[model samples]
Target: MARKAAIIGGGVIGGGWAARFLLNGWDVAVFDPDPEAPRKVGEVIANARQALPALSDVPMPAEGKLSFVSTITEAVEGSEYIQESVSERLDLKHRVFAQIQQVAPGVLIGSSTSGFKPSELQEKAPEPGMIFVAHPFNPVYLLPLAEVVPSPKNPPEAIERAKEILREIGMFPLHVRKEIDAHIADRFLEAVWREALWLVKDGIATTEEIDEAIRMGFGLRWGQMGLFETYRVAGGEAGMKHFMAQFGPCLTWPWTKLMDVPEFNDELVDLIAGQSDAQSGHHSIRELERIRDSNLIGFLRALKERNWGAGKVLREHDERKAAAFFGATDSAPKAAPLEMAHMQVLPGWIDYNGHMTESRYYFANSETIDAFLRLIGAGMDYVAAGHSYYSAETHIRHLGEAKLGDRLTGTIQIISADEKRFRSFVRIMKGEDCVATIEQLCLHVDMAAGKSSPASAEVWAKLKAVADAHANLPLPEGAGRAVGQRK
Candidate 1:
């Protein structure tokens, strides 16, 4: 059964929580007093649908059902997890918790308060142990960090369970050791925010200038290596110890107004707001959000390729999905086109004409063929061991259009095989319809010598079995046809 998550507020953070859980295959029930909550949350989910799948190497799980409920009571019904993202008012949060505990005191409840400590949130509560902090950054569906703060009143097991749930939804839960005013990340950000305000207030820099200083410089470094590591690299060959010794003394300098506060008057607000409007007012919030999402996807995918930092979290998620796929799979030969891969048409896959591009069609086929190769033991490890199958030629036929968000299935039918070479056919399907077909010839090679080579005995046995099963089936219509051939 699909697990359920209750989202107490449907603003940006709450909606992001909904999307994260829903996309990870958890049914979500959302409750927000705003009458426009449905439209608001729907927009966030639409952004998430395009952004999240692009990060995964494996197919995303079947999306869970999303429902907007009338009350907190309706939202928390049968919920295994609940995230409260209501307004930042203390009394408002206390009342929200009281209502939640009144009905379902046992269900784990988390708060998305960026500034409030867990102790503050847990006070005046009948079930304080169930209420803790789970502060996430904006665009929670894309970014992975969740600052989980638990007071001493909370049980260890419950806190661990909270972390596990966060990880399951592809979040990296940084457990805050003690209850601090604004958990780790926010504190650092608050310092930067204050400094940025001072810079604008003092006419030292414009909004766009500050943004450029970050994005063109440290922001790129920060995205991958983060603050300490980036500075550590700044230390040169001696590492962090050398860095701290050299730059640590600069901490006492009056380089920043870390201790000073700018007066918060109309003048200050207007300076910042007007500058920001001039900096980014041309694009609507949604348009800027799309731009941000696209940039983040590119950055995160780069990290995933290197298997470093936030990318590592994404890879682990894919690994978890792969484990489940293999454990439940029975790959014995059968008289059918073997379903090898499941894919989605992501944001970058569309061409100028708005159809899935031709390259992606070949990519879809390659994914199908690669999965089949892995199943038959001629995969990456086999290549690393100096023997593998390499595609010599391919022919693809596009029969129908596949638009964005369309789910695709790639299935393979083996036509024939020998010791050193094999021919196969693949069909990319959308539901019951086949959108395209690909036929390919592959040759096993001795990598060191760069010549055709016989397959390993074990791989040959498996491949021959599947090939033998497919031999009795009628040949796929386009199997041997050359380009521009008649019907």
Candidate 2:
């Protein structure tokens, strides 16, 4: 049976958790008090469906169903894991934890508490070991780091299980050794924030300037490697010991007030807000979020190619998600007799006829073939890597008229192929009637030099095997002879 996860809370964090689990093909049940919780959660998941795929190289898995429950018990019944992301108040957490413990005894319960320690959370539950703290950052679906802190009463094995689940969702979980007030990341943030406050008080720099300094400078390197690791590399041939000996004396200098706390007076708050407004001038929150998400996707994908620490986490998660949906290596591929998808006829593809032009039929049929190519590992990256096939020639026979607003479906089949080239037939159907037939001859092309080339031995073998397996299938009626030849 497929694994199930229940989330209590339908705000930003809870919605993000639901997106992550659902994208990985886990059935998710959500419990939230908001009357419009279902609509809001559905919006977040819809956005994730479009965004998460562009972040990684691999294709996304089939999305799972999202069900909303009015009561917590309905959400947690038969669920393997319960994630509590309700309000951060200690009392509220305790109330929710107590309710969860009563209904779901054996299931793992994780609280999304940023500051509260596990010991504090355990006080509300009947069995302390069943509850642990799994704190995640904002935009949890994209940011992969999660801090897992367990109490003394919690079983040791719970940490490992939490880690496994987090990894399954593409998160790097760090176990906090000892329970602290703010845990690991918040401690560093508090220090930096303190200094920022002092600078604002003294009018040294505005809030936006400080943010710019971090983002435009060292923050880029910090994404793939930590500060300590970067500094070690800067030490060069002499290594860390030699580098530290030279710079250690500066530690005593009166440079920073690491212990000082800034007062949050009205004047200070107003000054900071005014300066921030001056810095940004004018930009809507939605616009800023879109820019931030795009930048994050680019930076993370760059790191992913190298298989760095965080990159490896993303890669493993993608593989696990694919395996979960596509089945294991031993399992036979599920036969899909035919696949159908709805496509919006773009304005650019329309002709003076104000309808889908003749050429678009060939284009849409080709795109359907490209989808099959992706299933066989000949995807965008494969073409970009200078190892892909291009259509040498095509024959199209248009039988019926298709307008701009009309919906169309395409069906495709492989006819034959040798070492260097392959033949395919595609039929464009509308309302159970064949509208067009296209035959294509494609040859392996060397993308680098823009020249025809023989397919690699490995590629040839895979293509041959796929072609042989699909050969016996009859081509759909109306599929014509090679594009140049008449039927």
Candidate 3:
């Protein structure tokens, strides 16, 4: 059954909540009094459509229905979850919760409040035990960290349910142990924000300079290793104890003015805004967002190879996706050749001619092989078991041009299979037209030994089954053709 969620506000955070739910196959009913709510949410969804899929190769659930309702009552009537993202005002939140409780009190309700603690928020709720704070970072669809804070009044089951739901949508839910304003991540963020403001106020560093300092040095380290872990690495042979002993004294030095906040007067605001403009005025907001998303995808993909931090999260999600694909009963049609890969040309893969680049054809072939590997019960778990298939050689023949935005499909036919060697041919097409073809030879090996080896009994049986199924098909036209000039 398709679950439904109600979003009480449709600003940035609310819109993000909508995208997260909708993309995960939850019907979303959004209620916001603002006249431009639909347009705002639509824009956020557009950005999400471009960014989220780039994070993983998984085929996400088909997007659920999105409806903009005029009344909060209409939105919450049949909702399984209700997320409140209105302005950060206690009065307004109290009123909204009162209305929600009047209609749907038992639904799992969460408040996207960065500043308010769950205890404070619950005090105003009609059903305090059911609501908690579910704060998330900006561009919520891309970033997976969600802080789930439950107050003393809230039930433990609510916290567990929230964690389960967040994980289902690929979020890392950090359960704040106690009620505290700003939560965990934001506390660190606020400290940095305070110091940056002081730096600007004292004429020590411009906005761009401060940003460069973070991005060029500690920022990259923090992204993968985090603060204490990075410090532990810096400790060399000793570890965290040594690091704290060496640098703990520096914490008391007159280096930062975190105890006091700079007044946000007009002059200071103008100065900061002007410096920001001088730094990034050339690019539009949308252009800047695209740049940020692209960089995040690239960096996360690199980290994924090492299976570190956020990369580990991405890898685990991919494994889950592969598991679901292999376990599905209603698979591809039992035809002569199974459709192995179905994807659109991503914007980043285009060449000068606005078509998919030549190298991407081989990459697509590799992906096709991966899809087949998952189907044959040789997926991440198989590789983790120290056995995997490695490509020995590939021959690709381009038949036609594949333009950007073209939907491509790869159909596979197993040419032959043995104890250690498996060969397959894949035909890549754009809808009805054949665009390219690839012939690949792969060897099954004990990855730990790093040498060719016979496949395990189970894998061999699966491969033999596929080979038998494909044996009836006639040889393809270009199966053994050479690329050299013919006499």
Task: Name the top TM-score candidate.
Answer: 1
Q: List residue ranges in candidate 2 displaced over 4 A.
A: 34-43, 324-414, 417-422, 425-487
Q: Which scores better on TM-score, 1 or 2? A: 1
What is the per-residue lDDT of model 1 for residues 392-474, given as tens digits with 9 covering 90 to 100?
Answer: 99899988999977889889999999999999999999999999999999999999999999999999999999999888999
Give the TM-score of each candidate: 0.96, 0.75, 0.84
> Which structure among the candidates has the greatest lDDT?
1
Give me candidate 1's TM-score against the actual structure: 0.96
- Residue 314 in model 3: lDDT: 81
Off by over 4 Å in 3: 329-335, 339-357, 370-410, 415-423, 428-465, 474-487
lDDT of 3 by residue, 1-487 (tens): 7899999999989999999999878999999999999999998888887787777665566679999999999999999889999999988898898899999978888899998988887776778998899999988887888899998888898889988888887888889989888988889999999999989988999999999999999999999999989999998899989989999999999988889999989988998999999999999977887788889888988888888888887888777765655354223425377777766676566788888898889888877888888877789999999999999988888889887456677778888899999889998888899999999899998988889999888888888888888788888878877887352
Worst 10 residues of 1 by lDDT: 322-331
C-alpha RMSD by candidate, in order: 1.7, 6.4, 4.2
Steric clash pairs (candidate 3): none
lDDT of each: 0.92, 0.76, 0.86
lDDT of candidate 3 at residue 245, scale 0 to 100: 95
